[model samples]
Each structure stands twice: as C-alpha cells, then as structure tokens.
Target: MRHPHPLPPPGHAEVRIVAATPEAARLIAEALRRRFAATEQRSYPAGGEGGTRLHLTVDTTHTAAAPRPWPATGEASGARRLQADEI
Candidate 1:
C-alpha cells in the first residue's frame, strides 16, 4: 500500500485541492499554476465519495491549512469555506 503521508522529493512541494467537483479542482489547479508555477499535477477520484482533489507539485514552498477542526456533532447545515490559517 502507498504510504499515507509520502514526502515530496527534495526541492519540490505538494498542494492538495479537495473540492466537491472535478471542475472545481481543475479551476483551483489552474489558478495555482498561474501563481505558483506548478511543475506537476494529478487528479484522484475519491472513491464512492462525491468529490475530487488534485495534488500539485511545485518548485516552491506550499502552505497547507491548519489541522482540520473536530468533527461536527450533527449533520452539517452549510458548507464551510476556510482559509489556510483558519483550519
């Protein structure tokens, strides 16, 4: 099995985009490519779940969201869009 937390090769950075749709993921990747100059990208199907995400490898430092928040106690009322520092 693939390691859950694989490190990027030296001098490269990885960025993951978890979105509700493949188009959303592609848009995010395109935006990042314009800004960060990503060198590589791959999209992964999230199995039975209804979303997709893209992993981008860039030649620069990448920032990730802070640790995810504790699970909500009940059904989610609405989507939560969070920033990197507000994870």
Candidate 2:
C-alpha cells in the first residue's frame, strides 16, 4: 500500500534586497521582473538622506507545489530555492 503524501506548509518566502543606489536597485528589480509572472516596483524617499528607495516585489505562488503549480521554465524554477549563502 502507498502512504499518503504529507500536506505542504502554508505561506510563502519573501525575499528583499536593499541597495545604496537607484542603478543597483533597478538591476535587482529588472532581474525579478524577468523571472516572476507578477512583479511590482515602488519608490520611497530615504529619511535624512537625498537618495530614493526602490522596492521590488515578486510572487512565488507559481513555484509552490501541491495546492500551487510549478513554474513553466527552469529559470523560474531556480528562483524558488534560495540558498543560505545568498541571504
């Protein structure tokens, strides 16, 4: 007899990376935009400073299994697994 598969955990992993310059920040945003189906970008001012802040958001639902579907491409699949070294 086959055993039933365990239920996958709830929730998702949120990845955030802050940079010093707009250029560097955009680089990350662009990368995420190319990979994730749902990506968003927002700008905010840095308090007591002149430079602005960039926020990049990526939805990882496509990469989750069970209740969710897997990514169509390998590039998108790779984005799901975040290495400890990358953190």
For candidate 2, which ten residues in a row score worst on lDDT? 6-15
Compared with the true structure, what per-residue lDDT tens digits does model 1 show for residues 1-87?
788988888767788889889988888787667656576678898668889978888755543333445467554534766757885
Which segments of model 2 are wrong by more than 4 Å? 1-17, 63-87
Whole-model Cα lDDT per candidate? 0.73, 0.56
Summed over model 2, clashes come to 0
Kindly provide the TM-score of model 2 when superposed on the true structure, using C-alpha atoms: 0.44
Q: Each model's TM-score, in the order given?
A: 0.54, 0.44
For model 2, residues 27-82, the per-residue Cα lDDT tens digits are: 77766666563346776765566555776445665532234344554554234676
Judge candidate 1 against the unseen true structure and give its global Cα lDDT, from 0 to 1: 0.73
Candidate 1 TM-score over all chains jointly: 0.54
In order of listing, the candidates' clash counts read 0, 0
lDDT of residue 7 for candidate 1:
87
Alpha-carbon error at 27 in model 2, in Å?
0.7
Clashing pairs in model 2, backbone N/Cα/C closer than 3 A = none
